[model samples]
Target: MSDQTTNQQQSAAAMNEPLLSVRDLRVAFGTKKEPNEVIHGINFDVFPGETVAIVGESGSGKSTTMHAVINLLPGTGRVTDGSVQWNGRELVGIGRRDMETIRGREIGLVPQDPMSNLNPVWSVGFQVEEAIRANGLAKTKKEAKARAIEVLEQAGLQDAERRMRQYPHQFSGGMKQRALIGIGLSASPQLLIADEPTSALDVTVQRVVLDHLAKLTSELGTAVVFITHDLGLAAERAEKLIVMYKGNIVESGPSKEILQRPQHPYTKRLVAAAPSLASRRIGAEATMPAAPTSTFDVAALAEAEGHGSKPGEPVIEVENLRKVYKLRKGNFGSEDFVAVDGATFTIRKGETLALVGESGSGKSTIAKMVLQLEEPSGGSVRIAGKETAGMSSSELFELRSKLQPVFQDPYGSLDPLRNIGNTIMEPLNIHNVGDRESRKQRVLELLDQVSLPRELATRYPNELSGGQRQRVAVARGLALKPEILVLDEAVSALDVLVQAQILDLLAELQRDLGLTYLFITHDLAVVRLIADRVCVMQQGKIVEQATTEEVFENPQQEYTKNLLAAIPGASIELGIVEAGDHVPHTPVAGSGSAPFAGGGQAGAQA
Candidate 1:
C-alpha cells in the first residue's frame, strides 16, 4: 500500500472506533481484604494503527495498568474496579482460557528486562517458534521455524538463523532484547504493548527497531502502547502522550503539545529534565560559535568550565589497550574475537570523558580492563603515573579502593539480601576503613551525598524504586572514596527526571571532590549533557575523539554523524527554552587528550 493510503486508512480507523478502551481502570496487589492499589482509575484508548505512549518514572503504575488489562499482573495484582474493552468485548473478569486465546493473537506484550522475560533454558529460536505456534500463526513445525527466523530478522537481529540456535545467555544484552522483540512481534497482533523495548539497545539499533515497529503499524494496522521513561522518544514516536505519576494520569494530549507545553507540574519537570531539551538549553545559555544547524554547542559548555585550557594531572592513562576472547568451536578449534583494539584514552582529575558507541563496540570491554575486572591481552594502564600491568593480587585489591565501577543495572550490581547501609559499608569493612560506629556514620554521610534519605539505610534493594536503587549504588561506589569512577551505561535505563538528578549529583560530587569519571554510554544526548570530551567507538576502535561540541557540531566521521542523527526527538522543535534560564557556568577542573587513531584529529583535548 502507498504511504498516503496507509495514513488515510489509519485516520479512518481512528475515526471508526478504538481497538482497546480502558475506562477508570484500577489495579491493586496483596490480599483481597487489604489490597494496595497501584493503578487508580486511569482511562486511555488505543486506536488501530495509532501509537500512544505512557511516560512516567518507575513505579508510576504504568506497567501495572497495562498488565491489569491483559490479566498478566504479577503476584496478587488484580483489577479491583473499572473496565477494559477489546473490540467492544468486556475483559474485566474474563476467563483465563479466553484471555490466553486473545493474549498473543489480539494483544502482544514486549516486556521490560529481557533477561528475565526470556527463557534461559531454551534456544532463542525455540522461544520464537513457540510463540508463533502458540498464537496459531503457523501450522507445521517447519513453517513455524521459518516464520521465527523472519521475525527475528525483522526485529533487527542479524544472522537470525545462527542466532536462533543460541541461548539467551550467549547473547549480549542488546541481542537478547532483540530476540524478545522478535517473539513479541511474531504473531503480528492487533495491539502491541512495548514496555521499554529499546532500553537495552543503542541509538542506531533503537532507530531501526522503532522504524520496523512503525512499518508494522502502518502495514498491518497494529496499535502500539509504548511504555517508556524517555520523554524524548515518547515525543518522537507516539501520537498521544499519557503522563502518569504515582497512580493517576496527570496529563494526556498530543505528544508534541505535551513536550512543548506540559500542563502538569510532573510533566513540566519531565520535559525540563529531558536530556535533549536540557542540552539545547545549555547550548543557548553558553557563549560559543553556533554550529551550521541549531545543534547544541556542548563543547562551549566544556570550554566555559575551563576544559582544555588548564590541564590537571592525569589520574588514569590507557595506551594500546586490547582485549581478545577465544571462542571455542566444536571443542577442538577456537576463533579469536578482538573486543578492544589498541584503544587509548587519558582521564584527568575532575573531568568526565564519555565513551560513546553502539553495543559490542568495546566500550564496556575497555571499562572492564581499566577496572582490572578483565585482563587485557595487550596494553598499558597507568594509575597515578604507576604502571598496573603486573600488579599483584594484593596490589590490585588496594588499587580497587581508588578505582570503583558503577554498572548499568543497579539491581544486578547490588546485593538484594543486604540492607542499603551494609551494602554501602561493605567496602569500608573490607578495607577496614573505620570502626563500627565510624563506618555507620560514614554510610549516613554517603547517603546524604547521593541525595538519598538516611532512613533508607535499613531498606533492601527490592523495596526501593529504580532511581533510589541507583542512588544506593552510587553511595556504595563512594564508600571507598574512589578517585575515579567507571560508569557503564549508568543512566541509560533511568527515567529523564531521575537521570538528570543523577547527573547533577555526579557533577556536584565532581566539583566538591576532585574525582574523575569514565562515562561509557550509548546515549549521545546524555553524552552532550555530561561529557567534557567524547570518544566515538566503532568495531572495537575509536573512530572520532574530540570535545563534545566539536563532535556534535562538526562530526568528521560518518559513523559519529549517524550516531548523532539517530538520537530520538532531535528533529522535534522544542521552542520552550526560557530566555533567562541557563546552566550555571562553573569552572570544573580537568583536561586530557585521546589521540584519535582513525579518520579524525590526533591528540584531541577538551
Candidate 2:
C-alpha cells in the first residue's frame, strides 16, 4: 500500500479505540449551603484520533463540562453524577496519586488563558522543564531543559533556545499560548483538552497556533476535546460538533451537518450571529424583525456626515509614524526594535478605519500614537487639524477628551473596587461634566443606551458578564463624548452573539453620535462587517490600505491576501437557516429567555 493508504489505515485503527468517553456527566458548584447544579447529564465520546468541539456562549456549561472531563472543576465545583472514563478508567473518583500520574502523562490540558496559566515570575524554560521532569520525560534537569526547547520549537515557537530563558511577561500573547501548548504536549499525552486556547489571539496567529496544534496532535494520535464559544472556529476545526445550551446537549453531530441544518434554535442563533458564517451585518433586517419604525436613523447620519462645511477632514491623520524600542541585549549592548516603521491612515468623521495585522504588526502602536499615549520616535500625528508632535501637556489633555480607547480586556481596563455606576461616573466626575445628580442620571441613561439593565448600576465590575463589562467600557468611552474612539480588539474576546451585539451597538452609536472609530483588530472577518476602510499592517509598516470591500475582494499585497485567506472558517460555506427556522435574537448573557419555544436554552450570565 502507498504511504497515504498506510496512514489512513493507522487512522482507522486509532478511531476504533475509545480514548475518552463521557457518560451522563452532571456537574455542580457553589457554596456547600447552596449547591447549584450546572452541566446537566451531558454525554459525549472522543475517539483516539478525532477532534470534538463543545461550543456555546459563556456560562452555557461548555467549559464546565470539558473541565469535568479532566477532573479540574473550579472552586467547589464537583462532578456529582456520571462517568468520565479514559480508556475505561474512571476519572471522576480517581485517586490523586493515579490522576497525577495520568494528568501530564496521559491527559494534558492547554488552559483558557496562557498568560494567567503561566507563572509570571518564572522563566518559560523553567516551566516547560518542570512539566517534562514531572512527567518523567527526561532524565536530568539539563536534559529536561533541552527537551523543553525542543517541545517549544516543535510547537512553532521561534527562537526557542533564547526565548526559553525569558519570563512569560516578555512573550507576546500568541507566543505565550504556543509555549503553553508546548508544555501541554511535553509528555505526548494521549488526550489534550484545550479550553478556548486561541480566543485572545490574532486571526493569523490563531490559524498558526491551531495548525501547529493539529499537526502535532495528529502525529502523536492525540484525541482533542476543544471548548470554545467561537462557532466558526468549531465548524472549521472540529470533525464533530456538540452544541450546549444551559448545561444541556442541545445538538450533537458532524460539524458540517450541524452548521448546515441545525436542529436547535440556540445553535441556529449562534450560526446566525457568527460574522464569518454570514455576509450581512449583525442584526440586519434580513435576520431581525422588520418594523415600520425608526430603529437607527442611518439616513439622517448620512445627511449629517461631515463635521466641516460640506466634507469633514479626517478625525485622525498619521504620516510616516515610527516607534523604536531599544532593547538591552547585554550589559552594554542594545538592539533597536522597530515597532512601527511607517503607518499612515485617515479616519474621517463618522467613519471606521480598521488597522489589521498579526501580533507585533504595529496596529496598537499606531493606536497609541493617535491617542497620544506613545511619543513617536519619528513622524507626525494630527488630531482634527492640530499637530500632536510637540503639543503641551494641557493641549494633549485636551486632545484626550476627543479620543478615548476601549481595550481588549475590559476587566483589566476597569477598576475592581468601583461599582459599575461609579466607574462610569468617575470619568464624568473627572471631567466635571455635570453636577452630582445630573451625572448620576447620565450614568443611568448611558446604561439604558448601552442596552444594559439599570439595576446593574450598583454592581461591581466582577458582578457583570464579559459582554456587560465591555458595554460599560463603551459607556465610559462615551462619557467624555469623544469624537474618536480607538477600539483595540474591543470585541475579539466576546462570543459570536455578544460580539455581534457589541458591533451592532457600535454601528448604531456611530450613526446617532456621528462618531469616528479607529477599530484595531486582527480579525479581517470582523473588519468586513464594521470597517469602512481597511489598513493591513506588516512588521511595523502599513502594507495595504483600501476600502473594506476592495481589500477583501481584490487585495494588492500578498500579505493582505494571505491574512484574508487565513481567516478561520473562510472556506466553510454555511447555509443560512431559513427565515422560518430562525429564532429570537437574544443577547448572549444576562438573558434568561429561551431562543426557541421550550428549548430550555436559558443560561446563566458569564
Best prediction by lDDT: 1
lDDT accuracy of residue 547 in candidate 2: 88
Can you give the TM-score per candidate against the true fold? 0.84, 0.85
lDDT of all predictions, in order shown? 0.79, 0.76
| Lowest lDDT block of 10, candidate 2 | 593-602
lDDT of 1 at 590: 24
Tens-digit lDDT track of model 2 for 1-606:
799999999778767868888899989887767889987898888988788898877557876787787777776889889998888788989887888888888888988656568888888889999989988999988899889988888766767887786677666556777888889888888888888777666777688777866875678777788888777788788999988887899899999889888878888888877887236443234343222132322332232222431235677888888999765455777677788997777778888899888776778778878888789999899878889888998777666666788876665678776677777877666655656656666666667566677766666665555556878888888766567889987876677777776787778767656778999887777887888888888888888889887888889999887887777888887756667875744442342321111211113222
Model 2 Cα RMSD, 1 decimal = 6.6
Worst 10 residues of 1 by lDDT: 597-606
Which portions of model 2 miss their true places by more than 4 Å? 1-17, 95-97, 140-142, 165-170, 277-311, 419-421, 435-472, 582-606
